[model samples]
Target: MSSRESILPTEADFADFRKQCLSSDNWANKYDKHGRQVWVEVHPGKKKNQVPKVHKIKCKMVIDDVPAATMYDVLHDSIFRKTWDSAMNESFDIAKLSNNADVGYYSWRCPPPIKNRDVVTLRSWQVKDDEYIIINFSVKHPKHPPNKLNVRAISLLTGYYIKPTGANSCVFIYLSQADPMGSLPKWVINKASQVLAPRVMSRVHSAGRSYSEWKQQNNPEYKPWLYPEQSKLPMMNPAELSIQKADELEQVDETFKVDAQECEDSS
Candidate 1:
């Protein structure tokens, strides 16, 4: 029921996410739509490492009909993700590191002229009191190498926090500071927080509304995320994954099509 002591995403990581979620200090409000709001903050890259400037994004909404637990399930269900995540090109669990942690792969479609992107991440989840936290960061996996099909992106920190508000209502917050590895236009970066973030949030909200019905007919009792004992995934050694660095990946400018084959090859 318990995992090995200490992991890549320590409790401090979760605490920092929670803190940021609750505060709006430096985050600039981008837009607000039907109670769902988005904010963006640009942080300069460190001088020594030459890290790329990070765009910290926050999107939050309140749903009166969907429970927090159901939202948690909606986010974790890869099978269900196929039905809801329209932009997703590929996604799957690679290996399990613990009952509450794992490494996974995800690739998504980007708008025309922009090359598609993918990432391998060390993901972990936890349930504490009335809140549920799911967080992940980019990690290099030896067994799964980035192919030419998609530029390897880096998720410095990305995750969700869900908290119950009422019997059937909850607050859902998403926070991300990821670098889509490639030379991208300023407009593209602006669109991410302005247009893309809200669209993704809307999709998730809709997914939560209908997830309960879909789960009942499917494997209703199977929830590896909540009940890790039910996971059939093979155990993986934590030593195999290292924190992914942006400098290591090839920086291809996405303004021009990297490969036409990537679009055709996508399933």
Candidate 2:
């Protein structure tokens, strides 16, 4: 059966379904987790001519050996991000650094057949100490309207707190609070969080573990206090990478060419 012929609900029917789904008392329950509960609290503020939604998300992870300061470096390193962050498809160096902290920009392209659209974000990272770091990110979506969506700026605040658990092990706590734009039904957003949050968090934790292992294997004398220069790595230029397959095909020759003498001999 054709995909278009498959079971499909009309706009009104889907709207009714979403309305029923969002009305549930557990609509807010989508933010909860087991052992680690991250709450999403929507603020009661709105512009006179616009609808605004403010929410927060908090979660935690644990890492071994690597201190929070070094982790901050790892987080800012656009090249290292692909290792764990599935949401971010491409990143580039926007500017060179003068100190431990650097300003950089990243572009996110969701994994596809979804027709992944790109969103640009500016990030700032600051290390409080060997045990704490803070990251502030702002996502820019030119396609989104500024008035109706509270997440127009896509401002995200994240903090990482590291503490020693053992001689070679440490506990990593991650907290993120952000507003994602779109006129999506609250229930649909909640449902997506229920299904994908755990998997995403697991990926992040695994990323930390992998980085810790890499640090041990390579920098046995690794000092948690030092800001590593591991950020320098070749990244795809977005302009060149953004070309569509059709454009690439246009550059190729269509005619098939073969040596006439060789063809005749073979025949």
Candidate 3:
């Protein structure tokens, strides 16, 4: 084997990587920091000799709400997760329930544009009447394996911390760790996380805010259906048919007018 020197990623490189990861822009070059080696790999794919690995992502938010139980309920409740958690598109019913707390087996489907589907079995434990909650989840990739292009593991663990900030306020913290699986390159993992993690976290925060507002307005006691409605997102309007047709007609008229002018000039 030929001897080779490792390349380190510079600040500029990291900045450029961040920009690309966040916006899907192009990067001129890629480098590795710790390995201290430079390779000519210039795409989003797995690395050589890199096995599927797990990574942890943590997020925290402060919401205006009291009653630790309510905060925990909003965050840990399976029905509520469908509303706020960006990773979860839709949820299924839990067949088995433990008597001690709200424990059951649930599965989730990934959002659009991704071909893979994930099925998760999770359980939640409420600590001291919702003061805090311990959530454990394991993910299984039914479609892909560790060696595939989209290598994903079959297990993950997530925890939630909810504490009362004031009489009418609370703070929420979430931590998730999972293996991406396969031989994914480190740069790809970092890039994907750097880009998507923050956005997803932001969505979760926004969802929390919306949920809190809805709860305050409709107080579950007065309206039991409030939760369901809060979870349902409003559909976007379709493209305006009349406007498109009008634009097409304008284009046709302009073309004919130009042709007539050309003919008159020629004559």
Candidate 4:
């Protein structure tokens, strides 16, 4: 822990995190469907010089009887995460950078012929004005290098914004921008943003509500502490995962930028 504690994230990290949190709130209010407040949008990210071959996923949801804290716990609880997030092949903390910061490893299972992708990230969170913010960006860790088993990806931007609206109710916005290394067909990215994001978010909301009960029954002793672990994630090839309609597939127009602020103009 001391070795991990020695290194620290810069002020730039916190600055970006705050900007994202505020942006989330702004977007949540900006995007509406038929006068409805909750909105979700998934689009192909602009091929910025910074991050190429990326997708931008965003969502807003209000869960009944679930507080912001509960949602945070359900997500950060590493042991519980394994049960819900279908894409997560393996996830565990690598080190404690500080009380509010850490290094974590996350691997996702990809449809075959395409190797699974993983990343090592420095994560941090904060609670202010009853709004919770979680942010993580990829980093290079000495002990955790690119493994032979998985393609290493870079998480350019990944975060969650949870703001309380009422008792036991909160607004959630999730955003992700990542480059999953290897040649992932544009159709795969398109379908992921168009199809999978909504479906996965629905699962998250359901799981967030059921998590506490599931925890009590299963891993009651589970400590959500930030301790390090080297997980050897078994690669289980599920049958249903595949890219459909290769002939009809088309690439996202990389020249077009999908800015959140500009999303209101999207039909």
Tens digit of lDDT per residue, candidate 3, span 1-267?
Answer: 012221122334334322322232222223223212111223345574553343444444556634545656565445556655645434553322232222223323332222232333334344554356555444222221122222123334555566676776776655554433323343444455434544544555555556656656644444212233343332211110011111111111111111111110000
Better of 1 and 4 by TM-score: 1
The lDDT ranking, best first, is: 1, 4, 2, 3
C-alpha lDDT values of all predictions = 0.81, 0.39, 0.38, 0.58
RMSD (Å) per prediction: 4.8, 18.0, 20.3, 10.6
The sequence of per-residue lDDT tens digits that candidate 2 reaches over residues 1-267 is 023331122344333332332233322434445434344434345454453333334444445645544555455444446766756644555432333333334434422211222223333333433344444344322222233111122434444445556555555544444333333343443344434545665665556556756656655454322444544423322222111111111121213332221110000
Counted clashes in each candidate structure? 0, 0, 6, 0
Candidate 2 clash pair list: none
- Candidate 1 local lDDT, 15-68, one digit each (tens): 888999889777788888898999886444546346345667888998898999
Looking at candidate 4, the ten consecutive residues that score lowest on lDDT are 258-267
Error of 2 at 187 (Å): 4.6
TM-score of 1: 0.88
Candidate maximizing TM-score: 1
lDDT of 3: 0.38
For model 4 the local lDDT of residue 131 reads 71
RMSD of 2: 18.0
| True lDDT of residue 63, candidate 4 | 68
Candidate 2 vs candidate 3, TM-score winner: 2
